[model samples]
Target chain A: MTSDHDTPARPAGLPPYAIARQGRRARYDAASVHAILDAGLVAHVGFVADGRPMVIPMAYGRDGDTLFIHGATTTRIIRGVAEDVAEDVAKDVQVCLTVTLIDGIVAARSAFHHSVNYRSVVVHGAARHVTDPAEHDHALRVITEHLLPGRWDEVRPMLAKERKATGVLAVRIAAASAKIRTGGPVDDDADYALPVWAGVLPVTTAIGRPIDDGRVAEDTPPPPSLAAARRKFA
Target chain B: MTSDHDTPARPAGLPPYAIARQGRRARYDAASVHAILDAGLVAHVGFVADGRPMVIPMAYGRDGDTLFIHGATTTRIIRGVAEDVAEDVAKDVQVCLTVTLIDGIVAARSAFHHSVNYRSVVVHGAARHVTDPAEHDHALRVITEHLLPGRWDEVRPMLAKERKATGVLAVRIAAASAKIRTGGPVDDDADYALPVWAGVLPVTTAIGRPIDDGRVAEDTPPPPSLAAARRKFA
Candidate 1:
């Protein structure tokens, strides 16, 4: 569990545009969306660059209804948002951010019926280039702690230069939806009696042994934060 | 290793527009890009829908320079590509596809220096709806076999009705780039002397023991294909 300091309670509902048309597995409540967001480390961000679609994988953190993604200020996406902030017609950078966790692979009697058990959240939003000092600092903390829950407290405060060099985009989700698929594969009634063996092959992101940077004392152990992460992610 | 049957050789080079501007970690050769793509199961496909960007996670397979993504004909992305095929001026649907594999997390004394070791590939191309019977069949087999390698023979073949209901889009890659990051965190020289513990937390995707669908006899073991997958992914 994350330290509950600034962790806002999951915001209520999703916008109409964000509701899944294929409703069987759709989740509209903020809690459902937040759960998947918190569990993932990378988001695939889709945006229009030069009138063409572009997708980039990024490390992100969720704060209630908002998601923060950071990168160097000079990067293309960051620069695009900065320019959008100045444009008279465009007030914010539009993006579709999605995170997915693969839980299992479902094998069925027929190739057509094979499916996967996964949890994914898609957020459509107008993102702003974070400029306010307080919000910027908070976003950084959310990102740092999101990856290693307690690391923010163990590390020194952000440096002025470091803060300036990084860029944070805050995507206040205008619409969001989460889709989850679980359990065993559903096959055709006739195919069920076939000789084929079918089931789910579980998949997971495993946190392996940590290696020392070797700059520190050889015997020094990983900090409390990494230890906490080992337990949390596992 | 995948049971080699019709595995095409990696295509040659990337287009100029697809080449990474941030050249430090960019790989342009087909071999490097294919290695990451082949290792991945899902691709985040980015496309423009109704003048807005949309990102969807899809199962895809690669053959030489071509990538195939299949779905029901009614799906928005599939329909969009079909319409593009009919348009008088534009003959194909343009999209950006990306895949990522997280290898490890770098924990540093400073949060600013923290990073993750990952390998990712981005592909940009115009996709054509596959209407040829032979190509459609090949695409379906590729999609199925991509998930559980060597399982195509273990399952029943796709029926005619199933073929009629599915839409396969072939993206002949026009531009592509792969970026890879590895090893320990690079910290500020002065920060290395701090007493804080720093290291690399290794991460990996693990394939767990298979669970039976229970329709078959309980004693039946997972087929040889799943055994190969466990060894390959592990």
Candidate 2:
């Protein structure tokens, strides 16, 4: 079902659909793409429904080249894809998933050049529902571990009924691109000479002190895994 | 060009296009929607191109109910909208703009309940290129101040040539919805009795020490605006 225009040659390793608007900032290297995807906690999933575009934020995990996302069976994304599958077995749901991390705010001497230092990854592919029991179980584990390393080992195992209530969508990294903009503002040549102060205020996501759910026993302390996760970010 | 299905009754104060899938979490209040949009520094813009959905990240600003975003004139979004304007003077580009902020990671006793506490705002409407000089100028100011308060006054104003080079698009908040999830994970009753720990790990975006652009004079100190911005986030 793919058209010639949709399947472009992978020049410099970048998939045709994932080309960056800025040639200089485009990164197709697998390592770079994986790093950006791994570092991000949330991804914006884009899909077309009834010719209207919808973007929904969801937590995701990457197992090699496959990106896994799960939700309740009633959710729009899951239900929409399910309906599409039912209509035409040969067609998969087309999606464009994107992850962006804002590194810093660039304050330029003029409003025209104001920008932000950021790293973003865009993935384009067909998302298929993972119905196999083994793959579904593995996808859940990957997702839990992706959010909090060592969490899956400590958490109770998924029950048969619990697994059935959840639906996992796996999107292969068929075409992906990463774009990064760093450093300070690049202003108009004449405006840099102005007396205005211009610099980068670095932005970072920090994990604050953990708050217990109050149900934990008084003797119980923060787990080592939680402490390690905090330190990793710190 | 609005269709009957495209326009729905906003009985809850939410625009038809901005309806939330979860009725309980949906917020149509202007205050709530504005707060989420203002706090976020970037927006994921969803648009359709050639029957495919594309979501691109861009810096944006809000003034009253109108949202402003700018980019190079040659960019797909800008170019696409511009072409639409030329073809029909009465038509505007349809878009869905979304912003999401992840507040915490919710770890449940079982893999099925893992989630993230977040606040997200979705706005759906027609985007028109800002051709009015006064509105365009004000939009730039709002954008600069949105990133860093007290910034527009200190920085040099946009030059005529610089303004000409940029394409600014304004999308009125015709239909908007905000969804927020907070507190700890809501786990299954049986899993809560398990010994596994379950709680929310709070996440915050912090500003690190500012970095000078190297071109600034050595004697120049960090502006009070920068300090104020940091304290506001802190």
Tell me the number of clashing residue pairs for each predicted model.
0, 0
DockQ of model 1, rounded to 2 decimals: 0.42
Candidate topping DockQ: 2
* lDDT at B57, model 1: 81
**What is residue A19's positional error in candidate 2, in angstroms?**
5.5
Displacement of residue A229 (Cα, Å) in model 1 is 1.6
For all candidates in order, the CA lDDT equals 0.77, 0.74
| Residue lDDT tens for model 1, A125-158 | 8778898899999998888878788898877678
Candidate 1 recovers a fraction of native contacts equal to 0.66
lDDT of predicted model 2: 0.74
Q: After superposition, how far is residue B209 of candidate 2 from its true place, in Å?
A: 2.9
Over B149-207, each residue of candidate 1 has an lDDT whose tens digit, in order, gives 88888987889998898888888888787878888888888887777788888989999
Query: Which residue pairs in candidate 2 collide?
Result: none
TM-score for the A-chain in each candidate structure: 0.88, 0.87
Candidate 2 residue lDDT tens string, A6-81: 2221222335345534354667678888888888878888777766777778778899988998777776667777
